[model samples]
Target: MKKNMDDVRFWPGNIVVAEAAVAAGCNFFGGYPITPSSEVAAHMALLLPKVGGHFIQMEDEMAAMGTVIGASLAGAKSLTATSGPGFSLKLENLGFGYIVEAPCVVVNVMRGGPSTGLPTQPAQADVMQARWGTHGDHPTIALTPAFHQEIYMETIRAFNLAEQFRMPVILLLDEVLGHLSEGVIPPKPGSFEIINRTKTTASPEDYVPYDTSEGDVPPFAPYFAGYRWHTTGLNHDRTGFPTTDPDTVTFDEKRLMRKVTGNRELIDKVEYFQADDAEIGIFAFGSTARAAMVAVKQARAKGIKAGLMRPLTIWPFPNNQVLAFSKQVKTIIVPEMNLGQIVYEVERSVHSDMPIHRINRVGGVPINPSEILAGIEEAA
Candidate 1:
């Protein structure tokens, strides 16, 4: 049998992410090899050079993150990939990216662990860490994709959100989804819009890297591009110089946060399946959402009103959508690979006596559809 090669392509999940990043105009990759996510860097190493992009295996995870930030500041669409342990190592630099608003994508193909618990197994435990692993009240944008095709598209969106908001965007993938083989039909070139960071048109003499006069997200001026501005981890004024003044510090902090929070409508993405008039709402994400969707279908067949709300953009958390979904459903079932991370968020979102059940699994395995369906049945 001859298969059509016109629009069909088979790739492992990590390769899809790499190819998608390239398609999104990512020109630089600096990542350390870690299990489940190593394929992303390996494929990036092979693909980037073909497009006149650069790929570097850094000394370690921390350096990998630093290189990505530097490359992004030098006018490159930069990215890095890692798993749980490496993700932890990259947090300090990740926080720096938030403070300086460097545009880059960080891919965390999540495996089990607080500290290298399961290097080769799947887990959705990094959802909270992606949002708050770094210190301070900085902004965060994270996208979680369940399938190979979503991995491809969401990886591109990760780069887009990073460049658009001038901060690091995290692409979170469970180990199962990262290692799975699946077919993807990517859109043709120019089929969709790709975003690049807004560059400053101000002359060299008038460059201000953190200027908020125009909007919350300031135009970026790449280094060595005849533009000079200070970049620091400390709170800084519009000149990008460190400031201790209360007013300037306050203003800088608020703007950094508001860039993402104020644009929640643009950044938040939640997928609802069979949710309308659902009696039992299941909240899940990453690969677990995939299972939950199956559970919803099965429940519907069994004469149960089940729905699934999958948060594609994890941070920013899609609280509004969850709240609205809560109003329509009598109960919400939270299922995830971790012990119980996002369930707390669901409880907070509903903010009522609504019965929210949990179907959590740890120890390096995915939560299956049957388990979720059982949860739905119990809830019903």
Candidate 2:
């Protein structure tokens, strides 16, 4: 399986993700082997050393997340991969990454579950968890890619967004897509823009880690880069030191959220299929979107004016785009591997009396094209 970076190959989604991260300049990977996501760590172990980067198999999920955060602070584009239970363990440290503005990516190859429900099976049950897994108020950025090629591109974009937004970005991969193999021609280096964190030019004496004077997102000077600033889990002020003052805390929290929410247009993305003249819209993402796309075509064959709205960015939820798409269709069908997680978001976006239907599946099995087409047919 020897191949160059740009060479086209039939690769599994996890392998493509690892290669894309390498191309995106991910210099550090710290993760533990977890079901449905071990290939990502396995490949990273092989790739990082070739690029003079570091890869560590941590003791557990929490330690793995902490290591990536440390690497990011020390000026490396870092990442970690895991599944549902492991993703849960990473949340506390993930919360730390959020408050300290560590730019790194967390890949959750989702499987069945509230607990360790299914190790090798697929599920979209973690959609809501990815958004609210960490405690307290914070901004979230999560991406869902439906195919092998998309998984490659989106993996790079995940790192880009993490660096651009100065926060931890989540890449949600279901078990089906994580293991799915297909032909992928990864973009050659320098073909696409690769963004790194904005480093501060301020002198060490003048540097403030959380300084918002320039803008909502302050430039971050990496640790050991002749810059000194406090990093903490507690709410902090512009100096990055812990703060208890009501106004300072209020301002700090709002600023954190504003960095992402204020720049929604730049962070949000979606894909549309035959939606321009649709009477029925299918709202789906991740591997489920793959089935939804096929179902859309099948419905059209039956003269059903059906369309699909596949969101690549899931966290910020793409509310405005969903709202606009909802307006054009008389009814919206929400299909997900989980039991109606995203359906609620669809309902919220479409304030009109338009009927919103759902095709929910929680079994380890994927919703096939026929099942989704049947759902669309029923809605039509």
Candidate 3:
């Protein structure tokens, strides 16, 4: 397909976020229906066809992820969106995408819950799930956007990261961020970068799906059309075959890890407000980060040197950044909808430096800005 550089259409931020994936060349979606995150799938259902993409509502979350991996293996930019419970169910295939280094996007519109805790209420309980939900050792990129505009822009960015690293990227949005409607002007037509998968027309005699070249991400050729490729859940070599050969296994496993994990500079993004010359740092992500922002602004009004640290990329937690801030700040405030998930990461990253204070609300409501301000005050 020839690249279309023509200026496209502009849309509302919510619609633009959902539709931008199609514009960014994402054509396949497979997901089970769930609240909050469902809008992404729903939006794709209506919007994908106009751009020649495909949407499949599978029987369940696991199958949804499986379908995406299959579509991506066939050279399609694919994705799936879900929330808390749905995310838990998809871990197996999420791991599959990691082992195979399949390029796709998974959106988690976080809601309150261990098991269907709160459906409509907004919560950021899935922070660690977005990070370590899948088992074993593998690298993943997760982006948390705090508002409606971010939902659109972040989704586009997620697709790009997935293609560049040859791995699945997760867009971590909470219910508040997913459903929040705010006016936003999308990028002008032809302003977006749509990355397509790299395809090689190698002959049937010499092609391996996991063949490692100079890059951390090995080049892949699709099945059928004479390219013989084998994919599995077990650790394997570049030929994609099961093997216990320790050296080959170690190299392949670490290669998979380095493909995304080693490229943190390219993937690390955050929003900093009042960070410079601040005595306190309020660390947060997703929707909670929005409240943190307001709290930081209010703190500054009261002559408190407090800053908001929002990690736009959450999975590869910004440890180095946190360490730098911890050394400079007197206190750190970590808040979320969950009891104590991300706070643990913050604690670990900073070596328990300074006072690590936590204010969390787990009853299914988004902790308001005022409450966060009170927490910051208490820390101060």
Clashes of 3: 2
Clashes by residue pair, model 2? none
lDDT of 1 by residue, 318-346 (tens): 88889999999999999989889999999
Per-residue CA lDDT of model 3 for 1-380, tens digit only, reads: 22243533333333555776776778898989798777788888998888888889998999999999999888888988888899999998999998988899988878886798788777887777777889998887988877655666788889988988888999887777777765555566588776656665456787767766757777667756678888899988888889999999899888888876688888899888889988988898877888888899999999989998888888788998998889889889998888888898889899764789998898878888999999888878
Q: Which residue pairs does candidate 3 place in steric collision?
A: 8-189, 17-152
Name the best candidate (by lDDT): 2
- Tens digits of per-residue lDDT for model 2, 100-124: 9999999999999788999999999
TM-score, one value per model: 0.98, 0.97, 0.93
Query: Pairing residues by index, what is the TM-score of model 1?
Result: 0.98
lDDT for predicted candidate 3 compared with the true structure? 0.82
Rank the candidate models, highest lDDT first. 2, 1, 3
